[model samples]
Target: MIIRIIDGITEFTGKLCAWTLFAVGFFITFEVLMRYVFNAPTIWVDEISRVLQVWVVYLGAAYVLKHREMVTIDVLLSNPNSVWRRLAETLAIIVLFIFAGTACYFGFQLWLKATMAGHTTDTYLAPPKMITHAPVWVGSALLMLQGAAQLYRVWAEPLPSDDVMGGAH
Candidate 1:
């Protein structure tokens, strides 16, 4: 039951991230063509693209971590010996927690500051800075939550092969 829920959430997040990437690409391409061919650059395109890029990155980060696809030097960790492999996995989870925790803390702070400032982007479209920054809270919180969950899975029991290595098979 829990596995199914996680799988659904992970898949949804992945699709969301992919859609965001596509949107960013589309907007940027449109902006380039409009600027070069029409002789009138979009006033808000840059801001919109910037915002989309930020969303793509932070949101994608959580999905990446959830899948354990983030790069690591696994040559040493993938030792043939089970003990060494387990140790390396444990160490990696610990390090990930530390890094994720720190980033979440700071990301929250930045989000709070932006919210308090009540600022918006200086453009004709007047995009809210809060809108741009809102993802920081969502992304960091999700990343932190996923990090804790991963740590628990790492510590409590051996991850199911399908879960740990991904359901590639």
Candidate 2:
């Protein structure tokens, strides 16, 4: 029951992030059209778009990892037995956790420093650097959480087909 709840929550967060990405994309595209065609450029649209892009990429990364969709070279390790595949995937998840954890830690530190320094972008509609870095911190943390869930799933569930596996083609 606990595992199922975690999975559901993670899935919901992923979907929400995806929807946010779509909204941001649509808004940015509309802003661009309005600026070029209607000669009414938005000063803050570019900054907003850039921040949203970061959120989309990082959060989407976590979502993909949870869904076991990230690309990897597992041609040689593709095995029919459930145990071997699960072990290989667990190893892969360990490596991913290490990488994501490091990124999150450093990203959080960067966010902290940016917040302390009170730095803002140089624009007519300037925004804080923390605003940009916040996504990196949040997204990476969620990614780490999803990675933990994936690691659990690899051990709990039966090994899947290579084509449908995380480290597979």
lDDT for every model? 0.70, 0.78
Show pairs that collide, candidate 2: none
lDDT of 2 by residue, 22-133 (tens): 8888888889798999989877777787777887788777778866677866677776455767777888888878888888999999999989999887776778989888
Q: Which stretches of candidate 1 lie over 4 Å from their true place?
A: 1-7, 79-81, 152-169
Candidate 2 Cα outliers beyond 4 Å, as residue runs = 164-169
Tally clashes: model 1: 0
Q: TM-score of model 1 relative to the true fold?
A: 0.77
- Model 2 poorest 10 in a row by lDDT: 159-168
For residues 1-169, write the lDDT of model 1, one tens digit per residue. 5644654566677788798778878888898899999977878777877888788777777678777787766555554236666666667777766776777787778778877988777778877677877777677666666665666666566543433355562
Provide the lDDT at 158 for model 1.
Answer: 59
